[model samples]
Target chain A: MSLARVHNFAISLDGFGTGFGQSKELHFGHAGDRLHQWMFGTQSWQRTSGSRGVDNVFVRDTDVKIGAEIMGAGKWGHPGWEDDPDWKGAWGPNPPFHTPVFVLTRHQREPIEMEGGTTFHFLDTTPAEALETARKAADGKDVRIGGGATVIRAFLAAGLIDHMHLVVVPILLGRGVRLWGEDIEGIEKDYVIESTPSPSGVTHVTFTRKA
Target chain B: MSLARVHNFAISLDGFGTGFGQSKELHFGHAGDRLHQWMFGTQSWQRTSGSRGVDNVFVRDTDVKIGAEIMGAGKWGHPGWEDDPDWKGAWGPNPPFHTPVFVLTRHQREPIEMEGGTTFHFLDTTPAEALETARKAADGKDVRIGGGATVIRAFLAAGLIDHMHLVVVPILLGRGVRLWGEDIEGIEKDYVIESTPSPSGVTHVTFTRKA
Candidate 1:
């Protein structure tokens, strides 16, 4: 069976995956790119110039076989990008994700094909339904959960994730979207967790689903 | 020039220092000793026969020169211990804290002298006031912030904590008292942060105040 996976998702010491007041100018609000600076320093995100240390090892799966990508509306575009007809996405023409991207949003729109084999499909469905659609679209390959915390938290609550890689940054983003919530207590029972600390002041924690 | 420091404080992956329904039986509530199992394995807490690994390094500060400790009332006793006059702190006859320990609460009580060098003094005061009393009791030595989350969070919010050591456990407590709250945003600016992951499935994060 193809697994549901998440990779290189960053969260603060307080578990905030993204900060509050996100906008076109500040994609991560007051947090800016503080949460992702570790990933940026890795060749996985840059694909060219970066470190070859412990961080790169975790981020090395940038070219993993992901048949489909499921992301939230906030991660797709700004807060109100649905009204803007010209907003194809934050990515100029070609997004990093080269798969059938399922954008979970209440404001459903027609699928928009991007460069480099990336396509955006809007959906207004529940977590299980969305995962089912994404899995079918994945076509025997793994389905990647592209997150902004809120989306990943929902999938986690729904118990749809099989493997997740979370990079816990040392920074404290006081207020923002949390990857963990009160609704998903004892979630650790479903998976075996391992953590590796990087020299870049980040802890890479991976949770793999139990057999 | 005594510095205010915190050591070996444990919290869940969701940042809950302690779980809900804290009673006499359940000192740490639903969290029980799950958050502290790492510390329990360390020679620092055991005083003998424990692993001498990376985790032991962080927990090796049991003999640190701390002349005084300030903790929350919840840490001092159970639910309604104020009603029961015979109640001493949870540490039993001879407490672990061998110094002047101040318990913050509304109902003031006479000092309870334990078998060890520990003396419990109940006081109703603000964070600053509590620190002043602790510092005096410390008498040039360092004052440790003996916490139960709420007390530590209060000190952090009041800008009274000079150094803090937080151990992040991998468990997810769906409901509990969170150490990091929405009120104290952007707390990272005041300190220099560092994280080290141990094989015991815990990340030891230290925050030292900027000079």
Candidate 2:
């Protein structure tokens, strides 16, 4: 069985998943984008876009080492913009996520073709369908659940998630849309302290899921 | 002249103000709604809507305790349904913020009108303008910098805030957005802590701005 893990997901030191008010131009707002600076500075993010550069060792090794990528409807595709005649991918033609991707959405849309092997398919069914699709697509690789909290909670509640790696940045988006909320209940997690360092004053932590 | 405290805004445990997304229907998402549950259960939020059922001691002391309210354009208005126009305010006919509200936005929109003396003025001019407007409206009362993080940061960076209250919730968004980022540098804050316990397994902490 393929294991489900959310890797390189950054949380605030106060435990916020996303910042607030996601839009077409700026998804996840300013605070959300800040969480990505660590990864964005990495060669992984640049290499996927056909750029050449290298970040620090930390960014290269830990920030961008996901085996497979999974995301919810919000992160996968834009609603109204999907049909935009000029609607190219949100990222420049070459996006950071180069591997196979699974999108969790309620609507069915045609698979999108982009540079590299990236193919975006909309999953209109339940989490089970998304998981199955991701499992087959992952080819025995660890499936990384990319998210906006609701989707992550769905996987956690289903007990489908195996490990969680959360990078806690030191900022607090005092107010905005928020990452997780009252929706999560029954899921209990014992976080195994993987790493803790204050480089750039942000602490990165990883947890292993109990088998 | 009143002192501007930067860290006095209240934050939810999970780190959301009104919640995520653009759809007003989902505005303040459940966690956002739940964040205010305490205020709702109290006289502060309920009495504004003219519901006087008597609540706890905190409510008894702070009837309309909040001095002023601040927020972002994202939370002020949303795209209404096809038949209904988008010009509609976020809270429909009446919004909870009965006091003057400073809305952080780059777009130039006219001030909004609603019942209970709430007027949503778009602050494209500057953070100082918003603060000045809110202060004038506040009439020597404390100002509540309601936020989406960016707005809050603007106030914090400008040294325009006086106090902060953060309510740490237990859920994590995995990835949505963040609050503090690189732009914030060389600011000092001194606060007095006030802790309150709740049934939701969340702790509400109030920080008084100390000069």
Candidate 3:
């Protein structure tokens, strides 16, 4: 079975996945890159210059067995990205995700093939349908739920996530799109959670669903 | 110089100090004891039966070098506690805080002396005024900012907290009063934050103001 997973989803101390007033330029809004500075310091992020530590270990785990990805529209591009027909993803020509990436958006567009083994497939479907499509594309491998918070919350609310890796950043974003909602109350009952704080000052929280 | 500190204040993964709909019976509301289960498991909690670990280390740190405590009215008593003039406190006749405790409330009442060294002093004052009173009572010792979330937010907003020890529990209390607010957007710039995750599935986050 292809597992639905979320890897290295960073949130502020106040549980905001991304800061308020997200724009085409400032993807994280006022938060900037504060939430992900820890990951960027890891060897897996820089690939050549960063150090090998607990952060690198977790960062390296992100791409392992991730054959397909389902990401929110906000993550795929900036606001009103659907309106732009010539929109290539934020990852330039060769995106980091070398898989069939399913972008969840209301306005569906034709699949766009990129430099790497990546293809952007836009879908206007429900979480279950999207997961099903991503699972089929995964082809016996795991399906990664790439997020900007909303999509992850949707999948989590639907009880579709098998494994979740959330990095709790120490800084407080104050106001933004929060990860946890009322629908996710008592969600811990379904998963066994573990927390590991790295020397880099971020806590890695993993939630694995019960067998 | 005495510092204003917050110790062992447990917040959910969603950054809620206490859950929504707080009442006399349900002090932490929907959160119940989920956020505090880590502290309850520590050696400092049971005193005789609990294990000595990271949780205990932080738990023990809670009472060290603290002469006075400044807590919110919510922390001192339940909602509508003011109506009952005879109401002593939730900690029974003998409270845990062995210091002159100042409770921030709109309705000021006469001070109540408990069996322990704790004396509840009701004060209708601002954060600065309350801190001034607590600091005076502290007598060169640190004044702990004991919280139920609102009081902590007020102190943080006022930039009165010198050192804060926040425990990030694994559970997500989907709805509650949050610790951080719009007034504290760039508050992280003032504090040097440190995170340490314990085996008990909780991360102890400490914030020390930059001098």
Pick the winner on DockQ between candidates 2 and 3.
Answer: 3
Error of 1 at A120 (Å): 1.0
**lDDT by residue (tens digit), candidate 2, A165-187:** 66655455544443454554423
Deviation (Å) of B198 in candidate 1? 1.7
- Candidate 1 is scored at a TM of 0.96
lDDT at position B92, candidate 1 = 81
Fnat per candidate, as a fraction, reads 0.89, 0.11, 0.80
Query: On a 0 to 100 scale, what is the lDDT of residue B120 in model 1?
Result: 92
Provide backbone clash counts, one per model: 0, 32, 0
DockQ of each: 0.80, 0.07, 0.75
Error of 1 at B192 (Å): 2.4
TM-scores of all candidate predictions against the true structure: 0.96, 0.48, 0.96
lDDT of 3 by residue, A70-94 (tens): 9999998888787888988899999
Query: Candidate 2, residues B1-211: lDDT per residue as tens digits?
Result: 5443332233443444444554656655444454445456554456556334322443443323556777776656553432343464557678866877777766666676789888877677677887787777788876667666667767767767666555544344322234554454323334444445445334444556565
Clashing pairs in 1: none
For residues B114-207, write the lDDT of model 3, one tens digit per residue.
8979999998889999999998999999999999788998999999999999998878788888887778877888999988878888888899
lDDT of 2: 0.58
Chain B TM-score, model 1, reads 0.96
How displaced is residue A208 in candidate 3, in Å? 1.2
